[model samples]
Target: MPPGVPAPPRPPTLPATPVAADTRDTVAAIYRAHARELWRVLGRLGVPPAAVEDALHDLFIVVQRKLPGFEHRAALRTWLYAIAVRIARRYRERLRRDAHDPEQDVVSPARPPDRALLDAEAVRVLDELLSRLPEAKREVFVLHEVEELSAPQIATILGINLNTVYSRLREARKAFVREHSRHRFLGGDAP
Candidate 1:
């Protein structure tokens, strides 16, 4: 038995592979740390708040199971975002199918009374305006403005051109501002 050679460095465990179960704990830790922000991003991308928790859980489950195969060609957050957006899309599709059922309607998140008084009227006005926007414009608007994503990142996430993202953002801003101004003029400021 040789005792002076540091045990030959313990002979690496798993086979050399592109993906390994070895990364699971690290991935899970990163996911836990980043989860709230991820959900916020998905919500700003037009996922109803009601669907956000389930969507995030499902997304992470997929990540846990599939991430061993991840190629690392993109940033981990970007890859997670791609998954989140797909999950949000599926959530929206299901919501649409359930649209005609009264009991199936998605609920808006609850707001505290004091906070609602402070901001509800403005939020209500904005939500109404946003709801009226063309779907593409609303998506870009929320992603860029509410989610605070850069135009290039939005383009990448949505698989759209940068110019398209810019144009949609411009249109969304214009429409929202116009509607807000009108509402203000009409004194629709009650909370």
Candidate 2:
């Protein structure tokens, strides 16, 4: 306790707290669990295939930054899908601003040549049908049917009321079925 003695140098501050380590681990686990589904969901949500990978990366970046504050108001998958929807919307807006041709970004799924042709055609038809719906309806349809999320989950993810989800889903289904029937009547093979 000498008055002039310099205080002992503070113990080297640890670079990160255990809480930070826990956050990092949580982020990693979330990525491992949901990355692939989010990638697919992004593409289905209207992120051009060429940009889906970037969209997925951007999604995880947001997750990493915001996840510590996540309140668990919804299931993790629904929360992740909600994030993907926002990111995909941003990408779609950017594409619109850039006047990018999204069709050019469509890549056929890898398979035997014959099956690839069939699947490509099916995908094309489905995309066309999906594009015909209004955005709200399309979102409901894709979330409920394509992503296999329940109405309540879609409502949670889209921040809409559960009844609104049902309404949108009903309208979307009608629109989809109508369009699909037309395609079939036009001699297009049904997917």
Candidate 3:
């Protein structure tokens, strides 16, 4: 009926609270609010605990520089996760290049002995199981289970099909169970 008339502008679907015209302030606010999430995602991506903070710092550095171009086509968390995955890969490569061994480093001396032991065992078991999962599965599991992101959010973050995200999560759970059982059989820490 109105083919000859001009079309109206489509409203933006992305939420605008965290994203605004001032790039630096928007990015700084995001860092304040979501840096811990970035750290957790980086940890799941295989960034060593000692290096996770550094990786996070590095990630924000990228975000700070690129914030101006961020189109908000995706949720802020999804954008951060995508950046984290890339930074984790780079950090892992850098760790390999440097021949660093996180295990050989000294554990913190401040914690009580029993709690430290428990934490160490927990980390050992989790690392063992998560490392054995495929990279895709691990990311999906961590994003869905640990981070509590919805399937659609995880799909957006990973840029994968929605169905593929669900499959990976299912497979990751199975793989984790298998690995945990194996660890238990070996008397590592699993119950």
Whole-model Cα lDDT per candidate?
0.66, 0.75, 0.73
Q: Please estimate how well model 3 matches the true structure, expressed as its whole-model Cα lDDT.
A: 0.73
Tens-digit lDDT track of model 3 for 1-191 = 23221222223343333333355566677889998788777877778766676888789877765665555554777788888888987876777787975634657665422244236766656866888888889889888887898999888888899999998999999998888888888887663
Q: Which of candidates 1 and 2 is the stronger one according to TM-score?
A: 2
Instruction: Give the range where candidate 2 is weakest over 10 consecutive residues by summed lDDT.
Output: 1-10
Pairs of residues at least 3 apart in sequence or in different chains that clash in candidate 2: none
Per-residue lDDT of candidate 2, residues 1-191 (tens digit): 33322222323333332334455667787888888788767766777656676888899877766666665454788888998888988987888898866546556574322243235766657777777778788888999898999988998899999999999999999999998888889997766
Tens digits of lDDT, candidate 1, 114-185: 243225565545555666677678778877777677898888888999999899899989987877677678
RMSD of 2: 9.7
TM-score of each: 0.67, 0.75, 0.74
Best-fitting candidate, measured by lDDT? 2
> Cα miss at 71, model 3 (Å)?
4.3
Rate residue 157 of model 3 by lDDT: 82
